[model samples]
Target: MRTDDSGALDLSDGDPILAVETLLLTRDGRPGGWRRAIHRADDFKYVFASNR
Candidate 1:
């Protein structure tokens, strides 16, 4: 979760940001891993369905 530049949070008409990070060690015993992402909340729509 994140706040606006001015340090404010408002769901309505507010920009949403997403951030993720990953770290791992290779078989050779080397540490290396990093990931970052940011996007608006209403940028895209997602749908999920399931049947049982």
Candidate 2:
């Protein structure tokens, strides 16, 4: 998601996005503080969801 110029967290390198996705996909059972955090991309928000 594109952030406004003022007070924006720069994620142009995509590392933050990758890190968020990895954490969402690789966690074991039971939730933790990291899992409880809000993950977002541009204007889109993401959640840790499973088909099972």
Candidate 3:
């Protein structure tokens, strides 16, 4: 993920920061590859589905 200039998380105030327990990279619904979780502070979380 991306971080702001202040060194804090770039996510919004109300956004939930997922720990990225697992990552599945694929072109379609099928799993193409897997990525291990990296415990980096600079890493930002991403939400695929939004309630809004």
TM-score of each model, paired residue for residue: 0.33, 0.18, 0.27
Summarize candidate 1's per-residue lDDT along 1-52 as a digit string, tens digits: 5445224434444455444456777899798666555455556566779996
Query: Whole-model Cα lDDT per candidate?
Result: 0.54, 0.41, 0.51
Quick one: RMSD of model 3? 9.3
> Which candidate order results from sorting by lDDT in descending order?
1, 3, 2
lDDT of 1: 0.54
Please report, as a residue range, the 10-residue window in candidate 2 with the lowest summed lDDT. 17-26
Residue 8, candidate 2: C-alpha displacement in angstroms: 0.7
> Which is superior by TM-score, 2 or 3?
3
TM-score of 1: 0.33
Which residue pairs clash within candidate 2? 1-41, 1-42
lDDT of 3 by residue, 3-51 (tens): 5522354455445444445557567777766664433344665558878
Residue 12 of model 2, lDDT score: 49
Descending-TM-score candidate ranking: 1, 3, 2
